[model samples]
Target: MMLSGVVSAFEKVLIPVAGRISSNRYLLAMRDSFSTILPFMIVGSFFGIIEWVVIDPTGTVMGPNGMGLGMKMTGLTGEAYLASAFVATLKSLQALCNLVVTIGFGVLSLFLVAAFSYRLGGIWGGDKFSTALTGIGAFLIVTPQQVNKVGGFSLDYFGNKGVLAALLVATVSSWVFVKLTKNKKIRIHMPDTVPPAVAQSFAVLVPVLFTLGGFALFAALLTWFDIPPLNDLIYKVIQAPLMGFSQGMGFSLLYQFIIWLFWWFGIHGHNVTAAIQNTVYMPAQLANQDGTASYIFSNGFFEAGLMHIMGLVIAVFLFSKKESWRAVAKLGAPAMLFNIQEPLAFGLPIVLNPILLVPYILAPLANTFVGWLAVSSGLVPIFRFVVPWTMPLFFCGTIGTGSIMGGLLQVVWLAMDVFIYAPFVIAANRIDDEINEE
Candidate 1:
C-alpha cells in the first residue's frame, strides 16, 4: 500500500510537470522556428554532398578515413580526383550550392530571428511581419559589422555564431515593438483616407526606432567590457557550458534516461526535452560546421535512423507466431524507414509493459553505442551535416555523415539491434502461443 501510494504521487507530480514543459512558449517557438527552416537546411545538405564528394574529396568524408566513397563513385584517381572535382563546370555548380548553404546555414540566425519573432510577436497582437523584420534590425544593431582584409563587408555574425543572440533578440524586440505600437499615445494615427499598408508602416517606424536604439545600447555595454562580439559572448558565457554538459558517455546515458522515462509514462520525451536540445545539441552541430572535430553526439547522433528497421527484422524472423507483433511490424515498416516509432510504440504497445521494456529501451542505446564507437574509432566520419528528422534510413545516414560508411554502419547497428531483441521477441512469442492454446 505504501509503494502504491508513492507511485500514485509520483505520477501526479510527473504528468503535470511534463505537460507544462511540453506546452512552454519559448520552447515551442524555438522548435517551430527550427521546423520552419529545416527544409531549406536539408536542401543545403544536398549541396553539402556535392561539396563533400565533388569539390573537396580531401576531407574526412571521402579521404582515407572514409575509404574514398567519392573517389570510387567518380572513378577519378590520385591528383585527378582533386583536380577534376573542381573543374570549371563542377566549380560553378559547387559555387552555387555553397552560396545556398551559406544562405541556409551561414545566415541561420536571420531565419531564426524572423521565425521566432513572428511566433512570439503574435502573442502581443503585433503585426507579425513588421515585428519579425524589426527583430532582424535589432539583431543587426547589436552585432558587430566587420570588413575583411580584401575590403569585402562581412557578416559572419549573421550565421551560426548569432543563434543565441537571435533567439533573445527576436523574442524581446518583437514583444517590445508590439507593446509600444499598441499604445495610442505613441502610435502614429493616420487619417481614414490613408491606405492601410502605408499607415501601418509609419505606425511601426517609431517602434522600430525605439527597438533598435535599445539594442544599440546593449551593444555598447558589451563593447565597454571589451567583450568579443555578442555571439562570442553568448558562446563563451552560456552555450559553451551547456555544450560541455552535453558531452561524454555519461551525458548520453543521462539523456537516454530522461528520454525513455518520460516516453514510458506516455509523454513525448523529445517534445518536453526540446529546451536541452536547443541549448546544447544544436550549438554542438553548428560548432562542428565551424571546424570543431570532437562533437560525436549532436542532434544528428540522437536521431537514430534505422532502429525501426531492426524492430521489423526481429518481428518478422523471431516473432512469426505472434499475430499482434507481425501486424505491428507491417504497419511500422514504413514509419520506421522515416525513423518515426510512435506506431510501433503504441501499436506494439510497448509503453508501461514490462515484457517489452528491456528491448524497447535497449535498442536505441545499443544503436547509439555502436554509432559512437564507429565514429570515435574513425571507422566512420563524424556526422557533420544537418539531417532532416524524417529523411529515410540509408539516405539520412549518408547525407548526414557525408560518407558511405556512415550509411553502412546504420545497417550494421540495425542488425545488431535485431539480435539484441531476439530473446525478448522469442519470450513474447511463446507467451502469445501459450495464451492462444489455453
Candidate 2:
C-alpha cells in the first residue's frame, strides 16, 4: 500500500511537469519540427543496406551472411559486357543517398525553420507561406555562410551540426515576424482590386524586413568581432555542453526515463526529445559509419530490436486465455520483427494502462544500462555502426556492433523484459478477473 501510495504521489508530481513540457510552444515547435529527421534517416538507412550489402566485399557484412544479391551482381562490373552500367547504377544509388543525407542531415535547418514558422503563423494569425519564407530567410541571414576559395559554400553551416543555430534563428525570428506582423498598422493594406497573393506578400514585408535586418546586423556584429559564425558560436556555447552531457552514462537513465514516461502518457517520446537526439546521439551514429566510433549509445542502441523478442515471448508463455494479449501478440508479430513497435505500443496498449506501465517504462532503461555496462566491461563489442531500427533483433545488434555476441545480448535483454513483465501481466489478469467476477 505504501509503495502504491509512493507511486501515486510520484505520478501526481510527474504529470503536471510532463504536461507543462509537452504543452510548451517552444519545445513543441522544436519537437514537431525535428520529427521528420528520423524518416529522412530511415530512407537513408535503406541506402546503408545497399552500400554495406551490395558494394562491400563478400563475407564482409557481419550479420546477414547469405549471398548478398548486390554483391552477386558485381560480376557484371567487369568490362566484358558493360561494367559501366553496374558502376552507373551503384553511383546513382549513392548519389541519391548523398542527396538525402545532405538535405536531411546537412540542411535540416530548412525543415525546422519552415515547420516552426508555419506553426507560428497558425498561432498568430499570420500568413503561413510568408512566415515560412521569412523564417528561412532569417536563418540564412543570421548564418555566416563560409565560401571556399573555389567559390563553393560549405554545407556544414546548414546541416545537423547547425541545428542549435537553426532552432534559435527560426524560433526567435518567426516569433518576431509573427509578433510584429500581427499589428494591423504594420501590414500593408491592399485594395479589393489587388490579387490576394500580392496583398499577402505585401502584408509580411515590414516584419520580414525588421526580422531579417536584425539578423543581418547580428551577423555584422560577429564579423566585426572576428568570431566564428553564428552556428559555430552557438555550437560551442550551447550545443557542445549538452552533447557532452548526453553522451555520458550519467545522463542515460534520466534521458530514458523522461522519454518512456512520455510514452506512458501516450506521447511520442522520440518527438519530445528530438532536439537532444539530433544534437547529441545522432552525430555519434553518423560517425560510427567510419568504424572509428567509441560511443555505446549510438542510433541502434535503443532500437525496437531491443524489445523485438517480447511479442512471441508473451504469446508463448506469459498468458493463458487472455484473448487481448494473444490477439496483440499475433497482430504485432510482423511489425515487431522489423523493430517497429507501433503495433505493440498501441495494440498491447502500453500507454496509460498502469498495470503494464511499470515494465513498459523500465524495460528499455534496463536494456540500455545493461548494454552500457556490457560495453564498458568489454563483455561485448561496442556498436560502431548505425543499424536501422527496422531490422530484426539478432541482426540489428550484430550488424550494429559487427559481433555475434551483440545479437545474443539483444536476445538476453528480451528475456529480461519477459521476466520483468511477467508479474505485472499476472496482476493485470487478476484485476481483470475481479472486475469480470463483479
State which candidate has the highest TM-score: 2
lDDT of 1 by residue, 306-424 (tens): 35445644656565667777888788777666565666766776655555555667777778777888989999887787765666666667767878887888778777777767666
Provide TM-scores for the models. 0.65, 0.75
Clash pairs detected, candidate 1: none
Q: Candidate 1, after superposition: displacement of residue 262 in Å?
A: 11
Scored by Cα lDDT, where does model 2 land?
Answer: 0.67
Query: Tens digit of lDDT per residue, candidate 2, span 1-438?
Result: 343454456557766765676577655655555554556655554565555454443323411253444435554323431334555665666567666656545666666678777777766677777878888888777766556666545676666565566667777877788888878888899998999889887888888888889888988988899987787776566556687686687787777888787766655566456556666777777777676667777766766335633733463355535777778778877666665555566676665555556777778778888888887899888777665556677877887787888888987888887777766666656666666889
Per-candidate Cα lDDT values, in order, are 0.70, 0.67
Flag regions of model 1 displaced more than 4 Å.
1-26, 54-77, 80-86, 149-156, 239-247, 255-366, 369-409, 415-438
On the 0 to 100 scale, the lDDT of residue 363 in model 2 is: 81
